[model samples]
Target: MRHATTSDGVRIAYQIEGQGPPLVLLSGQANDHHWWDGVRNDFHSAHSTLTLDYRGTGESDKPDQPYSTAGFAQDVIAVLDELGIDRADIYGTSMGGRVAQHLAARYPDRVGALVLGCTSPGGTHGIERDNEVRKSLAQPQPAARQALLELMYTPAWLATHQGPYNTLGDPDMPAYAKRRHLAASNQHDAWDILPDIAAPTLVLHGTDDRFNPAANAPLLAQRIPFASMHLIPGARHAYFEEFRAIASPLALDFLATARQR
Candidate 1:
């Protein structure tokens, strides 16, 4: 485990595995560094994979306040500075993808390549929740938690992982954990800035991503000057899990090509 202090004095936690060129994994809402457990080993074999717990999640310090994609981007930059890395290939999922887009646009020199998964371009495509889903998100914690679980995972996944989902009620999590999670969920929106990204990008989305429609993938790819799009078949919002076999190869190929460029 490693730690870096952001410009705002927030302590960010991260872990480095394997070796070679640097590759950073940025997770989505309600997730932390451990979210990459399934694919970390594969990524480690080809590059130095750095997985970090964003400020308000995982083992990192959590401060009570609003969270923004801009703040998260700074946290990532701070980590890179602490490690003396000039540039890195970045992979972000959902909300993390928004951060990556902002970083590539705001600090072009720091990004070697970019990959966005299951994310949207903001505006009409980003975070525009259905009325029912929006209402559920506005509810209090107990009810909100149930709504989140249903929305985040498919019925098939829930059927198999019921025990793990049920354990969320263990009551040991810090109050701020839930607070920050919800805060992030409600506050995140970066659709207005997608065009500023210039780094070579690869956008991956599942064909059946009910959370964020698959159309957003093309919308993003079309906006980024040098972006490519890949649609994973038979996958949902959790495309990484369903298309790991294909997605990993595609990611490695894109990173390799981007590095050479």
Candidate 2:
């Protein structure tokens, strides 16, 4: 039930868990703070975890305007500021990674460490989802979930995360909000800003990611002077959630002791 208002007057909803160094969790497009439900607890035991619903999703107010990556970053800063946090580790997934990049780049002093998972740097250098994946995404929830699982998790891990066994968030974003989110995601470009990031960063990717493609991982590591890359074999885009047993610990270790520039 916690909330913070952006400088633009938009109210953003957020959740807090754990108790140590602050670690903010930024989810990908079309989802809310609940999106992190599957994996956020992994960091709760070691760090104070903060998960916020974007202005257009979950319990947050959704304005009918174009959403931008920079805007999302600013929202992050607002949350930190409201909580009286000076600096903390930030972890983002997919489109959230794009926002995290801009957050670290634009507000360097506010981020101590960064983790980018299953994301792209955007611009002309980034890869796009193939037509087939795009088609699957447009299907009804039943079929769409099935299609998404194929790209999100390894075949063997699928059963544990799909159907009645699923534990993901039921993001309440409206159609308009979804479109705004997609528009922002489409326009996200962190290529130029990446080199300016001063916080130590970890670029984590799944080898089987079809949404953003694993090839973009090295590009992120190479672009940010203080970034390193990790590619998990037999994993896919939703590794952080589906494979938290592995991915979450790696993230904790990196943000736990990863040297900051």
Candidate 1 Cα errors over 4 Å, as ranges: 124-127, 132-173
TM-score of each model, paired residue for residue: 0.86, 0.94
Q: What does candidate 1's lDDT look like per residue over 89-159, in tens digits?
A: 99998877877888888888999899999887675555454687778767998898777666656677777
Instruction: Report lDDT per candidate.
Output: 0.79, 0.86
| lDDT per residue as tens, model 2, 209-231 | 99789999999999999888898
What lDDT is reached at residue 85 by model 1?
A: 95
Off by over 4 Å in 2: 162-171, 259-261
The CA lDDT at 117 in model 2 is 96
* Angstrom error at residue 206, model 1: 0.9
